[model samples]
Target: MSTVVAVLGATGGVGQHVCSAFRASGDRVLGIARRPSAAGSALRLDLAEAAPAQLAAALTAHRTEIVVNATGGWVLSAEAMHLAHVQIVERLVAASTLMPDPPRIVHIGTIHEYGPVPAGTLIDESRRPEPQTGYARTKLAGSQALLNATAAGTARGVVLRAVNVCGPGTTSASFLGAVLDRIRDVRPGDRVPMTIADARRDYLDVRDLTDAVVRAARAPESTVGQVINVGRGEAVAMRQLVDWLLAAAGLPPDTIDEQGAAVQSKGGDWTRADNRRAARLLGWQPRTALDASLRDMWHDAARRYSEA
Candidate 1:
């Protein structure tokens, strides 16, 4: 039987991928976003401020069995982050309880929630989250809210703490996305200014992350009420990744005018995931190659820039 899936923040990078993954799997997808597009069954709804009754009605009307909370704010103000991450989650949990058969929630979280890990250490789901920035704190709060609802029997919830996701359609604010923008704006002699190039991060293809979400949504009750780390389980230096991207874009090494010197890494120079739980429970792993993902990002960005 085809599952009815409701994807919140459906227009966002990860949300769009999640919606497409579900539809590709032959499931019915209902995309909910503030500015819903003509993709799938679009529903324009502000989940943060929408009444619980109204939200419940929408889910019930669509017969949604699984709801993916992909809405999040990265560089927004603290107030905006709270609204997007925390308040919206609280509202969703409340609304789900109102349904006769509450929909299972798959909350998309970030590795930032784990804060700074030791250089060689891998973060597991058991590690207590130490969110430092407002973004991380707000996202952690949202994940906690969903888990709490599951514990209270108000909802079935699973939190996937994903690492840096890179692929086509990456947001311009992301590290790789920023690099693509820089490449697009680079003139013959202009030097690209970047930050945190020395830091090592585990990057997962957006498609891999979406595959994990689909698996988590279809997982049994035993997999619910748990937090799983979703990532490639390997770390690559930011500088190396940037160099690869530049090379892929047909830019010469000398073309990079690192203004003065490379950006110094702050604390938490490494971020890698321990995907044992994800593999054991969700039966998933990163299948896309990093080089392939970077190539796709370059092509996608170039296409967008040419069209603009």
Candidate 2:
């Protein structure tokens, strides 16, 4: 049966893509945002300040069947972590459960939950979470909260631990998005400063991640309470990505800047997603390789840069 999907944060980086994917799949999608416009039944909703009753009313009014909690905030700072990552979960838990039959909740999570796994181990659903930073801790907590809400019959939930998802319209404040902008503006003598992590990790196109979410939402109810990692199984080195960006931009190697600077660690461990579980369970697999995804993002970023 076609489902009614309500995408929270429908205008966000991942939410926008997820909303687009749901529309493509013929699901009835209603975009909920704090700044809604005439853009496909937009509603003004500030999840943080919204009461449970308000949420329930919104869902009922919309007749939603699937709730994609695609809204998420990230920061390298503690205060931002609390506001962006933690409070959102609490709000969702309160608001969604108020519904008569709460919709399936697909909460977005970060790869940082698998914080700093051993240099060689592949991170899958089975790996126990070892959170290191405020960001990871809050995200891991949010994942747990969503699961608890599911077990309590408040809502059915799925958690997607996504990696460096990138695309156009991403903010420079983001790790990969900032890199895309920098690469687009590289001159003949610009050496982009980056860390030298010999570690390998997965990357995903935001759209591909959205595709995985669509599949997961359509997944059998039996797959609820599952936390899946979404990424191409292959891991790419940070340096390799830098080189790929340079080549994709059609810039000469002279534009590559290699300063003798130590790469600052983000206070977490390296980990890669074991996507076999997602593939077996939800039939989800990453369609875009990191190289290809990067190339696509470069074109989009370049175009945006030109327009600006």
> lDDT winner among the candidates?
1
lDDT of each: 0.86, 0.76
lDDT minimum window of 10 residues, candidate 1: 259-268
Give the per-residue lDDT of model 2 (tens digit) for 40-71. Answer: 53778887678778888988888888888877
Q: TM-score winner among the candidates?
A: 1
Q: Write the per-residue lDDT of candidate 1 for residues 217-277, one digit (tens) a residue.
A: 9999899899999999999988777877887787765666565455532125689999999
Error of 1 at 284 (Å): 0.5
Prediction-by-prediction clash tally:
0, 3
Clashing pairs in 1: none
Per-candidate TM-score against the hidden true structure: 0.94, 0.91
Candidate 1 lDDT at 105 equals: 95
**Each candidate's root-mean-square deviation in Å?**
2.0, 2.2
